[model samples]
Target: MMAGPRPNALSWLGLSAVLVAVDQWSKWLAVSRLEYGNPVPFIDGFWNWTLVHNYGAAFSFLSSAGGWQRWFFTALAIVISTGLVVWLARTPRSDWRSALPFALIIAGAIGNVIDRIRYGYVVDFVDWYVGTWHWPAFNVADSAIVVGAALLVVLSFKSPDTTGKGG
Candidate 1:
């Protein structure tokens, strides 16, 4: 039997919750402490805490799309998060490799969703730079999503069967 749902499923969900909490907390800290358009250097050459808002999908795609993209992205995130939770619930408890990435993705989706619902934009603060060149500012949720996507890429090469568990 499936034993209903494994204990580790809850554990994985718990970890996802932690990621969401941390992501939200870090965003809160940035919002409270950082001044908009001003970069606070965290590392001399490479990193800075800079506050910005993303109203679009990754890399600000559709950010310029009037105003509906916020709702579009929010709905998309909810759908994806629901799907990930279902997958996480079905996965075997011992399957850390698969569960880890799905959990991260869920956390990230929800984190951004909260932002969309609350402020209509995601609060991003991490700024990476090289002298005059700069990467777009991003936040913890963005980091989680990227890490999860990267893990999925790595796992895909390691094994063709990468889906977590059930429907």
Candidate 2:
């Protein structure tokens, strides 16, 4: 039997809303409560809260690129988010494994874009790592993006016959 109408659009919008809310809230709290680089340990060495402003891409790729990267990254995010929205709209909601990741990525992208536009940088917190090998500071939006990307990688490996085939 043919599948009913796809719920991709609804799922995308719903997930995006959740991401946006959580991302914004966390950023707000980070800015209001945490001082820059002052680690507020949650589990002492495993996790901590700290505020950081990233003006460039992941791991501060263009962070020291003489400041032009701010607008460049912002524009890139807008373009990417637009494309993801279109992709999400075209995808069938029944394909949850695929659509869900796309929605998450789109939401995460939009969340960072909002910060870039409003604050000129993304506020990062929630540091995690071992003794000295600290992971770069990041926020909820980054987490969503990373998770979504991981899901996409997993979905990419799934057999076509297995996807969207209810067990």
Instruction: Output the worst ten-in-a-row residue range by lDDT, candidate 1.
Output: 158-167
Residue 72, candidate 1: C-alpha displacement in angstroms = 0.4
TM-score of each: 0.89, 0.90
Candidate 1 lDDT over 26-79, as tens digits, reads 999999999987999999899999999999988898999999999999999999
* TM-score, cand. 1 vs. native: 0.89
Residue by residue across 2-108, what tens digits does model 2's lDDT show? 97865655466787888899999989999999999899999997999989999888898889888788889888878888888888778766677777888788888
- lDDT for residue 143 in candidate 2, whole number 0-100: 87
For every candidate in turn, the CA RMSD to the true structure comes to 4.2, 2.7
User: lDDT of each structure?
Assistant: 0.87, 0.85
For candidate 1, the per-residue lDDT at 108 reads 92
